[model samples]
Each structure stands twice: as structure tokens, then as C-alpha cells.
Target: MAGRIVVGVDGSEPSLKALTWAAGQAALTGDALQTVIGWEYPASWAALMPGVPPEFDPERLAKQILDEAIDQALTPAQAAAVTRTVVGGNAPQALLDAAEGATLLVVGDRGRSGFTAAVLGSVSLHVTQHAPCPVVVVRGRTGA
Candidate 1:
């Protein structure tokens, strides 16, 4: 059976690189490409804000980020072949769920987090340790 490759993407530079790498791997292996992005309210949302805006849509924003990342990272035809998934919740769990049946799970060494010096971001570290499939944490400069 043909395989499916799942990749976690945020609007980070490392994530963009990871997406591009995943796309190339998928193309080489003829695997279906699945790109997943997850979003949720900030932990301090209720504490920091007086009221939640009705117009605030985390899922929509997440989808927009994912879409833009795909567009920026891949060609038009390559982007069209991508299967986009917007998940509601934490990125690590979302990626783990999406990679449940995948042949491979790919992620950037670091995401949009502030920890640039660390070799792996929290999401990448978590997924690499827990993913069901073989995990590849794409290494690169973790700036931005």
C-alpha cells in the first residue's frame, strides 16, 4: 500500500523548511502528503483578557497560517497536492494524532517558540519521542 507522510507546520521559518523537505520526500516516495497545523487559545487568554472577542477564530487563523506556509514553501502544483488539516488543540498532540497511521512523521527542529538556542523545540521534541511512526526532526537555524 502507498504510504502517507505527516508533517507539522506553523508559520515559522523552520516549519517552512520542514514542509519543503516533507514535500520532496513525499514526491520521491510517492507518498500522500498530509500537512497539519494546530491552534488553541493562549493559556492566559481568560486571565489576560477581559472578554473574548466573538470574531476571534483560532481555527481560521491556524488554517490561514497553514495555507500561507504551504503556498510560500511549495510550488502551485505541489501545494495543490497537499492535504491540509487544521486541528484544534496543542500542536504536539495534534501532530501525534495525525501521524497515527502515517509511515513517517516530519517536523522542524524548532517552531515559533522563543527558544532559538535549543536544538529542538518543545513540539518537535515531544513528537519525536512519542510519534508512532519514524520521526525526522529537520535540523536548521531556529531563528524566527
Candidate 2:
């Protein structure tokens, strides 16, 4: 492959849309696709709250979400052409890090954060503002 296309995927509808778009671009440009899922411990956990431990494994959950998204957004051939990357850190920073040496960075307008419609999500905005390579934020189509 000539270059790598880095795509941030978090299992959201818009993210899947971005993934689909990125996959097509990767194929057209003869670039390898790297699907990245960045996660961090719950904010509340930082407080060392006296509560029961989390029942789910965040690492496993992240991998499942990424794999399911790949399955849903790409065909078997396309999926085989992709490489999954899992990182433990803030989403925006993780994406920026993954974009290093990449030909392009792609992400959704909003992730699972459930931000309001008034503005683009913070991660997308940050990547657009500071990513080393060109960044594409895929938002929902007006009438699609």
C-alpha cells in the first residue's frame, strides 16, 4: 500500500458511515485501512469511588464494538483489507496519534457521547483543527 488511512470507529451510526466512506477511499487510493477504537476508564473511576467494580471488560467490549462495526460496514473482502487498532486514552488524542504518518484521517461528526445538534462533536472538531493529515468528518446526510 502507498499510505495508510486512519479511521476512528466507535460503533455509532455516523461512525459506521465514516468507516464505509473511509474503506471506499482506501480501496480507491490503494491505501491500507486502520480502524481505531480508543477508550478510557470511566471518568467516575478516577475519583476512586467506593462502589462495586465494573461488571464488563472494557478491552473486550472495545474489541467487540470494533469488530461488529467492521462486519456491519464492510464486505468480507473489504474487512480483510483492514487492520484494527485499539488504544487506551482520550478519543481525540488517540485519533491524532493514529493519524501520524497517515495519508488521511476520517471520523464521524459525533460519537457515542450524544452531543447536541448545535455543534460538531469535540473529537471531530479537534481532529479537524489539529490532525497532521487531512481529516474528513462524516455527518448524516440531509435526506438520506
- TM-scores of all predicted structures: 0.93, 0.90
Per-residue accuracy of model 2 over 1-144 as CA lDDT, tens digit each: 499999999999889999999999988999999999988887787476556466756778899999999999999999988999989898899999999999999999888875766368888999999999999989844352
lDDT of 1 by residue, 1-144 (tens): 779999999989889999999999999999999999988888898888868797988898899999999999999999999999999999999999999989999999888873877778999999988999999888767348
Clashes of each: 0, 0
Error of 1 at 49 (Å): 3.8
What TM-score quantifies how close candidate 1 is to the native fold?
0.93
Candidate 1 to native Cα RMSD, angstroms? 2.0
Evaluated against the true structure, the overall lDDT of model 1 is 0.91
Full-model lDDT, candidate 2: 0.90
Deviating ranges (above 4 Å) for candidate 2: 46-55, 141-144
Query: How much does candidate 2 score in TM-score?
Result: 0.90
Which candidate leads the pack in TM-score? 1
